[model samples]
Target chain A: MSSTRSGGRSAIVRARVLAAASDLVTTKGPQNVTIPEIAQRAGVAASSLYRRWGDVGALLLEMAAERLAQKFPLPDEGSIEGDLRCWTEKIVLGLNSTEEPIFFRILLAAGDVAPEKRIKALAPRREQLQAMLERGRARGERTPTVEDLVDHLLAPLYMRALVGLPVNEALAKHLVERLLNTPP
Target chain B: MSSTRSGGRSAIVRARVLAAASDLVTTKGPQNVTIPEIAQRAGVAASSLYRRWGDVGALLLEMAAERLAQKFPLPDEGSIEGDLRCWTEKIVLGLNSTEEPIFFRILLAAGDVAPEKRIKALAPRREQLQAMLERGRARGERTPTVEDLVDHLLAPLYMRALVGLPVNEALAKHLVERLLNTPP
Candidate 1:
């Protein structure tokens, strides 16, 4: 009973910390948020924060992975084009979120600093996307490979984000049309 | 005569400083390279460095712009598919360059810090890509838009670089074929 209680407590702590970090990112921007502030906001000790995540960068990576995993809900649109359009629109909207660009910039910086850890952190989201594509393939839809998804779908959204370009619905539709070979 | 001599000296100083910055990026990596060190290596005063480039991030941006300007030479391989294939292969090779990834990460971090300046720095490369696409269109090829190029060509290369994915010749060929509707 005590072991179960401790496990439950640990889970609560994890959620609280991540929530606090996300809140700070939304409010003050990712570049401005700090570990001490996150700990204070989460009502956890700074040592606990450090122990759980070595630094703010690691914490941001964890937070990003979580956000990314939750962000891309699989679309059940009947056609491949419909599914892709829905998926692209959702992704574009996510990338254009006010807090998201900063969060992604932090994640990219984290990837530069600790690439292996970043890759590990992103594994859940990758799997999620992979599963969505596999489902499309299983449905007899002509799905692009994971690489194509990254290239044709995800890359444009990110490039626009990084370069401060607009991520609009039209761009999403264009990508879907291009990938599906449908007329614009 | 004096003004012309000063202009010549200024150009030489620009060359030396950029060379020093590039060498430092290659040797010590971009994150570790400092403005003072770059100035020292270039035999310029710290004040001169500041007056010209402002900071290490600014200097890195300038360096990146210069590098990007020279990197993507438009390929004219008779057919659109052949040209795009050649172009994508060159881009993959450039992104895979040992020095280039570090340079790009630094630029991305700089974008986080000073986005407007980063965008301005990237404008030249955007124009270069635009001109290439327009040239393809002039040749009666169904060239993708600047946005499409960003999404289909540039985004994947950068995503691979940022996320530690394999950016190879095969991926380049696939992107070209997919874009041009040519048989794989």
Candidate 2:
């Protein structure tokens, strides 16, 4: 019972800290936000933050995963191309959004970290995409490997995002067309 | 004449620094090596290291680009599938090697400080892949967008690399087949 209570409290603290960090990221660019500031803003102790997250990268990775989950959702459009386009548009929009660029930037920054963090941060996104692909396959889309589909459809967005270049709807449409028209 | 000499000197210094850094990364893990240490090994002043490379991430990015360029000439394999398999297998071998994982980890870390650096670092590899795709297309193998083909074929290698997982030759073959079979 004591352990359960402690776990609950820890979960609550984590949520609060995540919320505060999200706001800071939105308000200031990700590079500007620091852990102590996040703790102060969240009304949590610095030691608690460190203890829960293990390090700033760990904390930022969690925050990015949470934010990305909320920002990009897989809408079941009932058609393969439609679903892909929807997903593609959502990702491109997230990358291109003026407000969320910092979040995207931070996520990419984290991805650019050491292999361990890059993989940990990427695993959640990859799994979610694979799940979406499975749904599409169930609906008879003739999708390729979940890994291939995700990489093909999303890599361009990541490429453009990291390049800090304009990615308009036209580019998104081109990517969708390429993915859809690609022969399996 | 003076301008040419200065440019040559700059290139030579850059090459030496990158070479020294690669030697260190091969011998020591990414997290264990330092910029000053790299400078000491390269026989350049520590201040020169900072002025030229800015930080370890900057140097790592250069080293990654240089090392990556060396890993592939791909081959005249006669078919896109064959070429891709061969190309990807080489990369898989590199990733599986004991030393290269740490090298990639450092490259990922560099991506954090400069997101643009990620694209720059990956540009040569992307171009080489793109060139191969173009050659395949010219040889009458139907390929979708060259960019998508490259990403689809290579992203998993990268995903696996970042994830700290082994990418076996069978997996590389599978990825290549999926990519070759997929039409954009």
Candidate 3:
């Protein structure tokens, strides 16, 4: 009973902190939101927040990962192109969201983000993408490698966002078409 | 004669500052090298650099643009694939240089980097790539649009770099292959 209560308390604190971060990022934009502000808004100790996230960038990254995955889970829509189009369109939408245009710059601005850090931040998304591709392969379809998807699909969308290009459903569909039609 | 002398003096100062910035960046890495150190090394006042580039990030961007273009001029190898492969391989090498992993993170970290600034930073290279594609069209080949090259070629390479993936000549060649073989 004691252990369960502590676990419940931990879960509440995490939810409150993430909620505070989302509110601040939506209002003030991402770069302006700081750890102290997040802590104060969450009603958690600033030290506790710092100990967990290390900095505003890491905290924002964690929030983005969780929120993006939860908000736009990729579907198994029976074809790689269909699933990819769905995923790509959702990612374009996600990038447009108030809070997710992202902390990528912040993370890199911190120090080019070590390989380990970059891997940690991307692993969740990569796993889901990989699973989607594995499903395509299991269906005996000629599936492009994850690297191809990164190069053709994800990279283009994210790079477009980074460079302030338009990211729309049509463009996302075009990227998926290119990914599928392109040869090995 | 007075104007001529001023022009000469300006050129000399510009060279000194760029050289100092490069040296400092090479020794200390891009993020760590500051305007003060660059100014001190070049024997110029910090005020002058501030007046020109506005920040370390801006200064570093100017340096990268000048150096990368100078050191790795893209060739017209008379075919889109050949030209792209040469360009891509050289870029892979360029990214491996002491200080060109780049100020992209720095610039973006400062802000999302206004589209105009991103355009200005990329304009010189874009012009060259455009010229190469026009040549491909003249030769009656099914040329990919400039946007396609950006999405398929440049975005992939830069994204891989951003993600801490290894960039090399073989991968560069592979990207060019994929870019050419893929239909619009």
Interface RMSD, per-candidate values to 1 decimal: 3.2, 5.3, 2.4
Local accuracy of candidate 1 as per-residue lDDT tens digits, A18-102 = 9999888888767678889999999999998888777788888788788867864668777667777888887887776654465
Global lDDT of each model?
0.75, 0.68, 0.75
Error of 1 at B65 (Å): 2.4
What level of docking quality does candidate 1 show? acceptable
Extract clashing residue pairs from model 2.
A112-B108, A182-B183, A182-B184, A183-B183
> Per-residue lDDT tens digits of candidate 2, residues A1-184?
9999999987888889989988887787666677899999999898877776666666776788766767776677787677777877877777655554554456544533555665575566667777777887898777766545545666556655543345667777876776667665
User: What is model 2's interface RMSD?
Assistant: 5.3
DockQ of 3: 0.39
Clashing pairs in 1: none
| Candidate 1 chain B worst ten-residue window by lDDT | B175-184
Tens-place lDDT digits, model 3, residues A86-149: 8888788777776545545444443434555565766766788889999999999999988888
Supply DockQ values for each candidate.
Answer: 0.39, 0.21, 0.39
Give the per-residue lDDT digits (tens) of candidate 1, residues B74-133.
Answer: 776765677677878877887766544555666676653355666676777778767777
